[model samples]
Target chain A: MARVQANGVDHHVQVLPAKGAPLGTAVFVHGAFIDSLASFYFTLGPQFAEAGIDAVLYDLRGHGRSERPPTGYTLQDFTADLDALLDALRIEEPVHLVGNSFGGTIALDYAVHHPERAATVTVVESGPATQDWAHTMAGALDQATEQLPPEEALDWFVAEYGAIASTRQGDGRHDAHIRRLGRNAGKFIATTTIARDIPDGRVLSDGEVRQIRCPVLLINGSEGLVAEQTAWLAELLPGTQVRVVAGQKHSVLVEAAEEVGALALDFVITEADKAAALEASLDAALEGGRTR
Target chain B: MKAVKATQTPPIPDEAQVLAEISEMIMSVLGDYAPPEGDAAITLDSRFGDDLEMESIDLVTLSGRLAEWYGPEVNFAEYLASLELDEIIELTVGRLVSYVARSLRTAATAAAER
Candidate 1:
């Protein structure tokens, strides 16, 4: 666990180094609100490290252990935070950006803005920050701002989601974790301008999104909010691969971590191998020229 | 917050000491959301999820505390990665205590040899 000063904010960051020399680095951007770096820490972070990839996980501003400013929750702010974080870490090489939900939006925006630094873009249950996205986010945040303040609403959220969590885990016991999520979300909503800033944030035009030059992978649940966007995204970013996990929903990362981890591991390894091969061939060509 | 030098490592802690440390870490992480029964509720057989109501995030915080207290040899994330999702869900405090005790012993032996 490390507190990194980036973008003038104290960000909670965790770097899981690979067992040996790292093949590459994958920065995991977690969802917003109730989610944090912990989502990746327990799931894909270790897996990535064990597979010889350094996994970087960090809490976005206003969430988890990161310092929460009263405002500046714009998508641009998030993208800049990621940029400053990489600089703070002194990571100059291109990195694979893996994002979930709102984090994916940030990743997409970052790729659009910093195409040189992003090796590949992988989004799970997320989409780009477009006008439609802003509209949807406004409504959701407005609802959260309205409902999350009341004690009864929090209780209801705990009861409802706790049951779902238990059922999903097949534990047959209600989980108090839901309460933690509810309370944290409630506090965040009540205190910050995230609700307004996110929607009012800068959105990407189709042309801007089309500027992403890296390999892209989009994974979404069949019932997830962004599953339909897969086709449109692929059209915008040619050669984008879309994988829809059947009978799943927005919580695909937690619900199907093993599957998602495997897919991610394979993607990174494949991309790394291609990069290695390209480097080796270039080195050989240079050696051949020297011999001549 | 005990500081141990790499060259002058202390004796391996017993399971009881490890448990005490873990319990303290748990309390620190849980804070206001700690169980009503308090530290006493955290026993050998206490399941983190069911009994302590710890989510994965809590474990992440606890993992950080573990590293701070026990040093890098007791890698909670790597230890957890070795387990299946179900095994992690059903993990017990005793299981963690044993792992920490064993890791510390190994580290101590290596330090003495050095």
Candidate 2:
């Protein structure tokens, strides 16, 4: 893990290099609620590295070791954080952008607005924003009772997050460390600046959807609220693809991290080829004009 | 937002049968529990989450089933957001059958213009 200061905040970013000379880099953005860099460390990041792509993971502004402000926890803030990290690292070319849940939404929004900086965008179990999500979520959080005694909450988080990873890793230790991580997650949840996340602003206008010209791959668990929404989004957007992991839910990325990472790697490489092709064409045209 | 255009096609002719089917589908996904019985009249004015115990998650599942029955063109998000049990009950199965029966509807009309 590495820390960099950007915009008056100390942002934490991690990178995992491919075992045998990486073909490219994958910059990962985490989801809403809880700041677990472990998700990147445990599976997705390593999988990308093994597949010859360097993996980069970072904490959102307030959730992890990063600095937090009194306000500005919206999707735009996340996009800026990701953008700043990429610039700080001097990654001049487009990189594969991967995100999960809320992080996925931020990635999609960023790619749409900054298609030039992204090779491809892979979203896991995320969707277009709805007006009622924030209010509904606030109501749910308010109804919380007793915070589930750390142990019980840890068990639940492990079950939810680990179930998906277990399918991919087949390692019992993954579950154990995740349980421990979940215990410490209580503070992150309690301190989450979700009140500033305006769901309405996150919803993409039809015009914005039309503008996402890059290739997109959307992954979702077969079982969950987001699975269907993910499918809905894929159908609406041009040059978009979809994959549903059977018996999976909102935590599909953790459960099927390897498969997800492989899919993302493939899409990113494919998109890179297309970008390279397009750049070659543009250069040829420019050269022709200069010769004339 | 596209305006809700006047439909040339009337509600499905067999209102009672269609309502029963939709209710049954809802019941199946909703778990083992007693639901209201009868014909098209039963569906008219039925409460959504209360009488049916149809939470938002449940509604989204039902919405998926509806999309499958209707067509891919419908905006599932907008349609679900714009609904309530009371409003749902008022929409006779016949009305639903026709709503899904049509094509060329836009998200604006399905979401805001309703």
Best by lDDT: 1
Query: Once superposed on the true structure, which residue ranges of model 1 sit more than 4 Å away at CA?
Result: A147-149, A155-175, A286-292, B31-41, B50-55, B84-90, B102-114
Query: Model 2, range A160-217, lDDT digits (tens) per residue?
Result: 5655433433344444445545554555555655543544245566578667766788
For model 1, state the Cα shift of residue B46 in Å: 3.2
**Which candidate number maximizes DockQ?**
1
DockQ of each two-chain model: 0.53, 0.01
Residue B8 displacement (Å), model 2? 86
What value does DockQ give for candidate 2?
A: 0.01
Per-residue lDDT tens digits for candidate 2, residues B1-114, read: 112333453344244555665666677656654454553333644655334544333444555465454444543333432443234323343445445434333433464566
- Report the C-alpha lDDT of model 1 over B30-90, residue by residue, as the tens digit: 9898876634568999999888888777888899889877888999987886676668878
Give a tens-digit lDDT track for model 1, residues A1-292.
7899999999999999987999999999999888999878878898999899999999999987899999899999999999999999999999999999899999999999999999998899998988888898787666656755578767765665544333353244434556667887878877888878899999999899888888888988777778556777899888898888777667788777778888888887898899889999999999999999
By TM-score, the best candidate is 1
